[model samples]
Target: MEQMQIDPENLISIDFENGPYSKTIRTFRPDVYTEDGTYYALLGPDKATGILGSGAGPDEALLDWDKQLAVFISQKHSPDDPVAEFVFDTLGTSKKDVG
Candidate 1:
């Protein structure tokens, strides 16, 4: 897998189904805005291949690098914003098809 740092503004579009999927996962740190905005960070692989969902923080989702993609399908949480909803939806479908 490849890895690179990107400018947040330059990350306007993310096509996870493409070759960049492996390099498209990372932890997100959001900035405060009058209205909520969605941020996408790439998650890298460590050991496992499952998705992890946690509501332990305020309106935030974290996907572990080592977890299986299937683990994310079982998570239940309302996306705080549209971008997040899109990410979850795409991830869910991808995981299902791959499984």
Candidate 2:
């Protein structure tokens, strides 16, 4: 079996904008090697509490992470609120999809 690895050099911070809100996201870079050739983007200390996204490549992983963030933000408001509706429309995913 192959082992998964992560490189400290891959750590990154990104400026994300959704609607009128702008925020920065810090990332724990995906494993350098994986059994399924998937890259996972992670935030927070562990999967249980962290936001996570996976894809075939790093960019896709990051985009998924952004969508996850949008879902997180939308949860703070009523579904019909403009901010909630805007993020759902822009990011296009639900909490289940992100987790």
Candidate 3:
């Protein structure tokens, strides 16, 4: 298994054609790996509140991660929450340390 430690700030949005319409998906930088043939996409850090997704393949696991993260985003919370801050401000494409 291989793992990559990313800055998360470099996350990019992908444009894909869905049938007749074009869609833009802000891709999460999922750490993809395989274990015993099952694939997994681990998002964020490895802690009690970390996000992890598992599936038969890498793409499936990434999809699962996106879905779970979407739900988490839809929930209400305070701006001071670390996880939420990281996900929406740090990990997201928003430029934080700008001039």
* Each prediction's whole-model lDDT (CA): 0.33, 0.48, 0.54
Model 1 residue 34 CA deviation (Å) reads 32
- lDDT per residue for candidate 1 within 1-99, as digits (tens), equals 212344555443433344222332432222211113443333322112223323223223223321333344346534442333444554454423322
After superposition, which runs of candidate 3 have C-alpha atoms over 4 Å from their true positions? Answer: 1-26, 77-80, 90-99
lDDT of 3 at 63: 74
Per-residue lDDT tens digits for candidate 3, residues 7-92, read 45433222323322112123446566666677666665552355566778666766776677767677664555555666666445
Maximum-TM-score candidate: 3
Clashing pairs in 2: none
Candidate 2's residue-wise lDDT over 13-99, tens digit each? 333333222242332232322225676776544444455666786667776766876566645545444433434454564634322
Query: Candidate 1 — which residues are off by over 4 angstroms?
Result: 1-68, 81-84, 91-99
What TM-score does prediction 1 earn?
0.23
Better of 1 and 3 by lDDT: 3
Select the stronger candidate by TM-score from 2 and 3.
Answer: 3
**How many residue-pair clashes does candidate 1 contain?**
13
Which candidate ranks first by lDDT, i.e. highest? 3
RMSD of 2: 11.0
